[model samples]
Target: MEMPSLYGRVLPSPPAVDFNSAEGKRLFSEALQGGTMEGFFSLISYFQTQSEPAFCGLASLSVVLNALAIDPGSRWKGPWRWFDESMLDCCEPLDKVKAQGITFGKVACLAHCSGANVQSFRANRATIHDFRRHLIRCASSQDCHLIASYHREPFKQTGTGHFSPIGGYHAGQDMALILDVARFKYPPHWVPLSLLWEAMNTTDESTGLHRGFMLISRHTAAPSLLYTVSCGNESWKSIAKYCVEDLPNLLKAESPDDVPTLLSHLIESLPANAGALIKWVVEVRRKEEGRPTLSKEEKERLFLKENVLQQVRDTKLFYEVHGQQYAKSCCSCSSSSEEDSLTRIAAAVCCQGVAMLSGNLASRDGLCCRETCIRCIQANGDGLKTVISGTVVSEGNEQAVDMLLPISSPYTSSCNSTVSDEIVNYPSNTDVLTVLLLSLHPNTWLGIKDEKLKAEFQALVSTDNLPDVLKQEIVHLRRQLVYLCKAEEAGSHVPPSH
Candidate 1:
């Protein structure tokens, strides 16, 4: 096996360290608090790790990714996960390269293509002082990370271009807090800004571009629908083959024991907002009647659409790269009766995370993800009403007469002749659900916090003419509301007088 050599010289050292020392422990504690770089030097939640021999660039990006809270798991308390080298290596664009290591340009390209917000700077045109001043300002908060790229050889390092997050900068001492991702080899320490700048000017053998810096900023965009919700997309087969077909290995569901762990990890990785949104969607979806079943022709056409296939590919790659889990071992699966069942379950759980994070964390019907759709409608002296465009009228779904009302099962078998007709003719269940959700909070879908409003909504659940599916959903929702109400009462909320 040919070993990695820089300038044809040998440097014997482990590629990374575990950071198990007392100082290492303290740093880890500080980082979890979301480290800072204020008048003093610190970076809370500046997640770090060891790098694979030739995966320094991938590893360094991972640190920046977490520090900027790019992944949903950044807010997690227990041991959190970040994108690993396996995921970065899985990139088809980067894989086509003939070079031994990733290039600076390629890393930036990959990050941007993956929906990561990034801004790069080259040392060739700028002075060290100019860069240092910027670093001091940007590093003042945990929302940005300065990924310094310089030649390691100048600093007596083995590699040509090395990358790590400059977590903190002390202007007084002209020192930079290097949160070295190559921890297996060395722990993080402060370095002279001038010396590090000299290293940045070194040339990279792969791209031939001078090594520089990139600040991975907070990813403000929501994950998109195309990136999640396979929802019987025909192109899913090819997408599975190309991108996440290796999910079994990526998620490491090698044994049955792994499934529960993977499940727990996936749930933990969900942001609090995403969880609330999911609950709202599932509840609202339960109220609707008849999902739009795909016809043979429409299903066949969608299965083969090039655009759909590409979407599946993007969604698959997105999860592998940004998924916050310890083991990338869940997705690898082969075609068999038993394994197929597990694969479907795992895929659904993982992909849902993508959907939840995206602006799509919405109604179960996959509608009303935007702020514009949320409108507040108050109740009258008689009862509640849905006011659309300033007019009061019976919505198609809620237009059912008392005779047509019958609580149905959640399963499809519950759809009877009367219900099926209503589903086809009055497909306004989602609109009604949308109004209900809007009533809670138009600005945020976190949850229904209004105890009095929730109490009033409970009356609607008891209507004799309500849909069975919707009623069952209300039952579940009431449980959540009960919990929320109790929590508020027990905590600090004061009840308002009528």
Candidate 2:
């Protein structure tokens, strides 16, 4: 059968010079002579086509991320750890991204979430001269990359908005090399810097936000071992409102004894977009209320989604319980100043340079990563054991064993070794949450009186008969927990605060 066209070609009418054309090669040679093609080799090494029509941003990000040797901290397909469009779901859901594409801010948010240093400039917020300077800096440096979100119409291209990494610059021609992710439609091309800025200056109709450019670089510290919660979604405001305004009011109006019932009501009354916070609660409730037996096929179908929910719940519980432990533990070093204390913690945990701190060492007021280095430590008797189980591969009988692993076995551990690690050093917040959950004691979940929450806790901590990858993740977390114990033991002279 004859195949239909996938996308239209980039018309020669566009002002941009195709990178493979004679004129393009001439300009690129000139760019190299002017020392503006320093970053070109790095990007070209990992250049990839966007897998989906609307996944240009993801593709560009993946290229830059890999070029910079940034670890995605998660497997891409099987055993290899790398960045892929599918792994970039922290800022926006993949389904939403596939349908609506992504915005400049969201792209920057994803870069930041992936443990890269991001500096974003919307067209309205920055002048043309500023963009030119950034372009030169990015093109002249292999350490950084520039991604532009611009309107295709300005370049007379076939699409609306687009994202592509700026691979090189030509000072003499005043041109920028766009390593367009949508290679099917447009090849790598050199467009006049002024013209590219004009494209980026246009407005995106959906977000009512200006198109822009961003500079992404690797973070100075090592990637974080644990995941943290992010408040970047549309439901963040409602979640915050519920936590700050609604929760306080609910507590004050109800008696202490009635609070539990009120909370249960609150769970039921929560808005549908309570987002990631409530799905696990609802799942847990359904599991307990129904306790329905399922066929092997059903369990296999639900495994991926359920595992994600469990990981999220685990991270939330960890931050709630031990977010402040690192600060407290560092203070135990008896350093004379906050800087000195941070220095000690860095030496102990990072083992390289200073471990990056989130805020003032005295307070846990912000969302810094307080749980790092737990993986390097060995799991003492108190921490969860590293249990290697069945492979995550989907088949007949093994799927049943992986699904039936006991989730809520009772666990007891001494609180003596429960010291916290570094803050906010992780790449994706999801990873942060996953690692944090691993460090948790079974008793932490068992202490909660709410049956739904308890069920959610069980899901988070359960390691029995899981897929190999997930079990490996648990082992990593347990390793981190072991470090916590070691840190606590070193400072055992100062008793841990309850």
Candidate 3:
């Protein structure tokens, strides 16, 4: 059987290259001498396709040779079996070589270049590492470029022999660049491109995943970008893309201005009706500023003013209802004496006699005698004195007069005797005198004269006389005694009848 000449149609030759550059010649010589025949062909093939190859020629050579070494019996195996049988063909391409190359290019660009024998390349660690490093360099040089690796096998059943490859690379130095190249659209197991880049740049392993899978990027220098993908329960696909770009921005914004702008952007990105919640929050904050704020002294002043105003209004209303006439009279009286006007006003309003004295009264405004009106006029001090005198006089009977004065005459001739009698008898009828005597105690009678004392004793006895019935009994007994004395005198010689 003769195979068709698929050389130009399937696997075309590489474009012409200037072997002028020392680096280029050195690479070419190394590939030929190292028994890496596929690597040399890959270099030539890369130049033939496009002016600037999308993938590194060296990386492509390493990938293909490594894949072939894993599966030696494959038809696509190259001439690299001379160095080590361990490096013989292992990766068997499912389609033709040209188709495989096209697939590999697309997969690499999408960051999914692990479809065929990627796991088998583990035996060739040097080749795999070199390939990964070359991809990183290529992607790093171009801001738009990204690369990724993946495991092509379906999810393994429990206890099955299937496994994942390219899981060791973190965000910063290795697999992170692939994530960055793919723009973080690779497998869910890969860390975010931004985080992988950050991790690579920062060299921070702690920033990325410990197990499962991770992505990293070099977006910032301070804190490395890092994100994890877990296959345990939840899917990482939904949040993976967002986390790469949004998380870094969220963590970096520190000022109020930045926060509001960020928050607005976040709100806008949410589903409809979510913006209403944020609007409500902002309104509440604005309302808080309008409520009254009070100071200690100002509050106290307001309270005092209210009390004074209430008092003044009450006083005015009272005067308007009861003291209108007196108020008019007070004007005339005030000219003669302000005390007199206040006294008249108090008496008119309270219906009591009042006196105003200089020592006992003063005005609220320091103009008129307000205290005199309150004490003397409203209290009727003069009328109280008169009532007291009248009470004493009305209580005076014949026995009362005798008890009060102890004078030989029926009537007390001296007014001094009346006063003395009143002073002495005061305690027997009044609580005030009793309290006064208690207060004076042993010195109570010190200033009292003998005549005054006699009058006081008489008054006390008179005030505390026996009842009329007892007095009548005494009178009858005295009469009976008189009759007996007369009968005894008349019957001096005769024995009194038994």
Work out the TM-score per prediction: 0.40, 0.54, 0.15
Q: Clash number for every model?
A: 33, 14, 40
Q: How much does candidate 1 score in TM-score?
A: 0.40
Model 1 scores worst on lDDT over the 10 consecutive residues at: 398-407
lDDT at 333, model 3: 20
Off by over 4 Å in 1: 1-46, 72-82, 90-99, 223-498
Candidate whose TM-score is highest: 2
Off-target runs (Cα >4 Å) in candidate 3 are 1-65, 68-106, 109-237, 252-498
How does residue 347 of candidate 3 score in lDDT?
25
Q: Please identify model 2 stretches exceeding 4 Å from their true place.
A: 1-10, 223-227, 230-498
At residue 152, candidate 3 shows an lDDT of 20
lDDT by candidate, in order shown: 0.39, 0.56, 0.22
After aligning candidate 3 to the native by TM-score, how far in Å is the CA of 408 from where it should be?
99
- List the candidate numbers ranked by TM-score, top first: 2, 1, 3
Tell me the tens digit of each residue's lDDT in model 2 across 1-498: 998866658555459899998999999999999999999999999999999999999999999999999976444643466888877876688899999998776677677667676667778778899999988998998999999989988788777999999999999879999998988888899998999999999988887777888888885643332222233344545643554355445544543333234334444444444333211100110112223354444344234434543544445434443332222111112333222332233222231111011111112122222222221112232222211112111112111011121121221221125422212121122233334344344443443455665575466456654554445444433432322222112211111111
